[model samples]
Target: MLYYFSLCNILLLYLILISLTFLMLGFYFIMNGIIYFIEYELFMLNGSQVIMTLLFDWMSLIFMGFVLFISSLIIYYSSEYMSGDKYLDRFIILVLMFIFSMMFMIISPNLISILLGWDGLGLVSYCLVIYYQNIKSFNAGMITALSNRVGDSMLLMSIAWMFSYGSWNYFMYIDFFSFNFDVKIIGLLIVISAMTKSAQIPFSPWLPAAMAAPTPVSSLVHSSTLVTAGVYLLIRFNPLYLDSSLSLFMLFISLITMFMSGFCANYEFDLKKIIALSTLSQLGLMMSILSFGYIYLAYFHLLTHALFKALLFMCSGVVIHSFKDCQDIRYLGNLYIQMPLTCICFTISSLCLCGMPFLSGFYSKDLILELYSSCYINMFSYFLYYFSTGLSVSYSIRLIYYLIISDFSFYCYHSIYDEGWIMLKGMFIMVIVSIFGGSMLMWLLFPTPYLVIIPFYLKLMVLLICLFGGWLGYMINKFNLYDIMINLNYNNLCSYFGFMWFMPYITVKISYIYLLMGLKLNKSGDYGWFEMLGGQGLFYMLNDFSLKNQNIQNNIFNLFYIFISFWFILLFLM
Candidate 1:
């Protein structure tokens, strides 16, 4: 029975998994620059064969190692965060499934095997997102599941599209396929699939909505597993689409996603949702960098992001749980005193998120910016890149102001403690990683690097933007700028920012209008007119004929005699 399964056991199991993963990781590191493949034939049809395959390379193994490490830490953190909850066992199982699915995705290079992991992620994530038996969780789950399903379907279609090539392993043809029209279509579909998975542009509403899940799920999904899956896939698929026009489209869409999420995070109030939006922003950053032909830089950022974002989520969980499950930032304050350890962890992660000098986020973010500046890009694109980078600082500072700097808005009499040692234990590991992971990964992954030649003014642009954004953030919160706008009859403008520039509204309106039209068409065309013209129409006509024929059957003998007599009389008269 679950009574026998305790939180301690879960942590112990995670510890075991962590040890094994580290062992494998060490082995893989020693074997770096080497590719190992294990394959076995599962079946054969005509000239085609189905095989089970696992590919072990530096990238895949390192990513898997990091994923396992973060997952184990998150599980350990959840021990405290989810303690006393009745459904803790189920939650643990869901987390395990999530981690396993991510591993499955990471190790497989075949499209067919990848789909197994892809769909598993979508299905398991839906279960996790709706873990709470509430209307909000249900709605969030529906949106999350439906949005991800679009990606899943696109992936499946792409798999079918690959049938012409007679192989499921995309790794083999990385540079073999020519950039023809058909190849472009497949590439386009794959990019769209990645966009949905990464929460780019129109697909972004689901990421914030998915904050309805428990903090652990949010940590896992937003950090190492679900959202990053798309970036990972694109990195692996990058060889095939290096020169495709679709990459240009992705570049713009990713920039927009980055800009939108960064600005929205500044306006958001819920602590978890703000963090979630930041994850979206970073995912966009990774995608945009990847689109710029910096796949390794993007991958480097993805790994570093997973480290700090997971820790950030875990810290937010502590704060939210301490505040009696209150998540609104408006009610949070003075955490630096009440929950010193948690606040410190949160601060480190927030600074890292802002790309503070020498932090984990700075390594990859700085390199990406310098490369972007040195590249021959237009003025508009450069502005979007720098502006979005600044917004990251803005939101990070805004979050810090509300949660740590201001006075506590919660009830004064309630006691708050920073005593969740288990949660803190998990966060402590990430604290080190958040500080050093970026630099370490940068050195390990890119032993040889390009010397980026950016102008001095552009080199200092990030610093200037951070300072300005930080000041704006402080002013906005310190003087109650949002309230001032409301008081001065700028409610419309405030609403737009608060509602993410009406993105959610647009998504809801489009979904509602189309759904209504579909229902009306079904009612009128399928159920009403079509049914009448097809099955019901035929049934009614046959039924009426049968009823009239029944009357004729009853009078058949009498009618025949009457007809014969009338014919005889007519003949005699003639």
Candidate 2:
């Protein structure tokens, strides 16, 4: 019945949405499918409306194009990749579910509807992650699924609070301010969920865990797909951020996530894990810029990052597929000779990622830095811009150096078999864009495309700063000179928060001494405090009550639970 209700709701949502769209959605999907076949780009700035009380904006449509583009690629790419796997039907079903959920998320008519799609994305992705359902992979997938559930819970509660406060006024973007509850409280909840989704700093472990999935799956998640959904959510809630005045808080968190993950990625051995961590860092950089209210720059970087990151992941997948499932970069070497096209594609993407001058990374990254520099009118904001700019360069350069120049000493040092033309063609197109699209974008942003533009040269100068910063990062990794490699002691993190990680050991040791003393005294029980007063006593009383009347116990239990929950909610609000 619940499934049927959800299905009816989803169908009802589509009916309302389809009625609003000028072009037929079915026809549009078919046309996108065909255009996907042609290897041609479409310049479409589409329309949207407030249907079913949800404000569907132009930005939502733009992001939807990205969602469809990547989902189509995943379907296109995985149809071949997962062809011989035994769970082929299951894979296709999960893919369809994922694609459907992504569409719902993009065009969701309400906060609740968007959240439903978010949960669906998490569910289907977890299934696809362990599609083979192997024990180790299943464990990883389950952990990530659990994390998503926690994030979902926070998001659901936040949306409920927002709606309850805003009531009917919650129908559109302008209605957020109509709510009576603390905007700061509401904003924190939204940002918390966003951080977990985007894999920011402390919550960053999930993406690496998600690498338990197939390479194609990882590619989609990294490149403007599900992992990005969180940042996109934050972007969507720009009104909330502006209301809460929490942009500085957001920028700080993003900057920390950016550099820290980058440093960590340097030490990782798994091919997918490295890319996944790099994606986290790069997305963090974009989110940090996004917090500055430069939405266009953030969106542009997202588009640029989508291209090179997906291309890199696809290329990496080919490499891993060849190694008979060995994913350690340490076990991969000198494949430029054997898989020339894949190597070229990977190199181009790596350079693009590094923000090398004249590359796609250069344009997107340079614009963000330009935006950052403009924020230097204020000293605090200037310091933030300075730190984040340095972090971006560090992480970007680290990824390139590890993939291209590091001495990983691959044990399986064999030539790669030539992949099919489908893979090669995708790589070919992506590399061209990675190299030259930066120049085109620079032209779009500046007058005379640089002929009448000294301001543009200043942009070039900022571009030089990024390149030099990346070069410094290359030297840092190339020298092997950091204690960052040996810093994985999680016990240290626990201790840094001033909790002794050895508390359990110390407690057990002291307990043993107490046990020896108690044995000497012939005392049997370790129970005390609440246990001595009403613990077993209360249980026995409950058991006696149950023996007297089971119905009475059930009613009492439900009554107190409801009363306490009501009081707690009141207290929390206060």
Kindly give the stretch of ten consecutive residues in candidate 1 with the minimal lDDT sum: 1-10
Q: What residue runs in model 1 are displaced by over 4 Å at the alpha carbon?
A: 1-31, 45-48, 534-556, 563-574
lDDT of 1 by residue, 1-574 (tens): 3442366456657755874575476446644656778899999999777789998777787888788778877877777778777777788888989889988999898988998998899999999989887999998888888789899999999998988887778877766888887688778888888899989988999899889899988998999899999999999989656766777788899889889888888778989989988998999899888887899889889989998999999999999888899999999988888888998999999999988999999998888888888877788988998899888888898989998899889997998989888788888989998999888877777778658877899889878988888888888889988888889999898788777788877876777787899999999999999988998999998999999999999999999999999999999999
- Which tens-of-lDDT digit does each residue in 466-535 have in candidate 2? 6666777778776754444336545455342221123324433554686688775554344644454557
> Cα deviation in Å at residue 564, candidate 2?
56
Per-model C-alpha lDDT, please?
0.86, 0.66
lDDT, candidate 1, residue 300? Answer: 85
Tell me the spans in candidate 2 whose CA falls farther than 4 Å from its real position: 1-56, 165-180, 243-245, 376-408, 411-415, 433-461, 476-574
| Residue pairs of candidate 1 with colliding backbone atoms | none
Best by lDDT: 1
